[model samples]
Target: MTDTSERPRADLRRAPERYLSRPEEGIETRHAFSFSGHYDPKNTHFGALLACNEETLAAGAGFDEHRHRDTEILTWVVEGALAHRDSDGHAGVVRPGMVQHLSAGSGVSHTERNIGGAEGPVRFVQMWLQPDAFDAEPAYGLRRVDPAQGGLTLLASGMARDEDGEALRLRRSDAALWLVRAGAWQPLPELPSAPFRYAHLTAGSVGYRTVPGPQGGGRSMAPGDSVRITGAAFADPVAGEDGAELLLWEMHSPVSYG
Candidate 1:
């Protein structure tokens, strides 16, 4: 059972405020949270989630090797293919419907590029989460999920309470990631009740409302929009005419920078 002692709060985050970055000619990134050179102390993080970035790269464009440590990085491809290579000897081409997970436990360096000789551009949404413990060995994982499988799919989980082996594992035992692809005007699956929940619309549009009361009113969400819910349960969202693809994070704990 969820604790409802505190009043439920729902906050909508429009996509227009996402910090835009064009570090290179063919690479463009829109960050939902404060990122490099874009600092917003009040919007730093929600729960264990540190960064949510939507990136697009032109063919033959890529990011050079970069270092990361003690961060759980998850990437979901929306269009085209992305080539990934890391110092851990892991290499793969991630495409739509695939989830790529990189646990930079202690430290690791990697490079990401838009696969050449294929599509026009590669677009993906990447999220970063704070791990429960730090300084472990680095790891990597990849899983393919079928959007048409029906209902919400558990793409990854680190929650101790979850025993689903199908989900790609995470390093934090208090966080989980879910994905859903809904048809036009289809009702979405019930959202998991958690102390902190963050929902991002990756494709199409959706209409959502808070449960019990109308704190947020019946609102429509466009692609790239996100909502942060604290101590609240929301009514299931319904897809718009073009259908919708959504990613949700269920976080039981807040960020601990220990």
Candidate 2:
């Protein structure tokens, strides 16, 4: 594994604190929201990982007609429904318990909207991955997984595997994303020892006990909270509340990229 000093620091939160004072971005038509920014490349302590802030869109809100190039955009809807329309002419509604993926290889135009119809709020997590190679071709996909699906379900990966099955095939990188829901913990399978792990909580709470390095120690995470654990084993959850959900990513080491 690469030196732990090269990785980001780890801290636990029962729930991510809301910084209401930040400026909001209009990401779609008649829609605007704040980003819990871990987005900048320089701010990322390891590999090509970048995470956005938690977003809560008011009813009838969303971004429209934006363009992206050479990045892998992944979204996890925490609550309510998110409507996605893309240049690929793909449009759909993603509700709780679903993951939306867009590989903006060369470039792609897209928009995201909160379809709550002015009834309630919509919350979710959006992340960007720096691809090993850029400007290939754009692609889109999603996986609707139930919390009872337990263990790991591949949302997007560089290779094919049959464990929990694969959803979207990504560009050139050995990175793989796994989604875990409530009930029964599963140990992370053998992976390159130097990889970096990013864990994002979408709902309820999960306890990570005695993981390696900074990720070690008991930490409780609720929705909107995220932790970056470099080269650590996916520890079995010692305990959980009713609606726990997690998104885990195994990425190439910083040493490899450096």
The clash count of every prediction, one per candidate, is 0, 8
Cα lDDT of model 1 by residue, 94-139, tens digit: 9999999999999999999999686599999999999987899999
Q: What's every prediction's RMSD, in angstroms?
A: 2.9, 5.2
Best by lDDT: 1
CA lDDT, every model vs. true structure: 0.87, 0.62
Those runs of model 1 whose alpha carbons end farther than 4 Å from true positions after fitting are 1-6, 147-149, 214-216
Clash-forming residue pairs, model 1: none
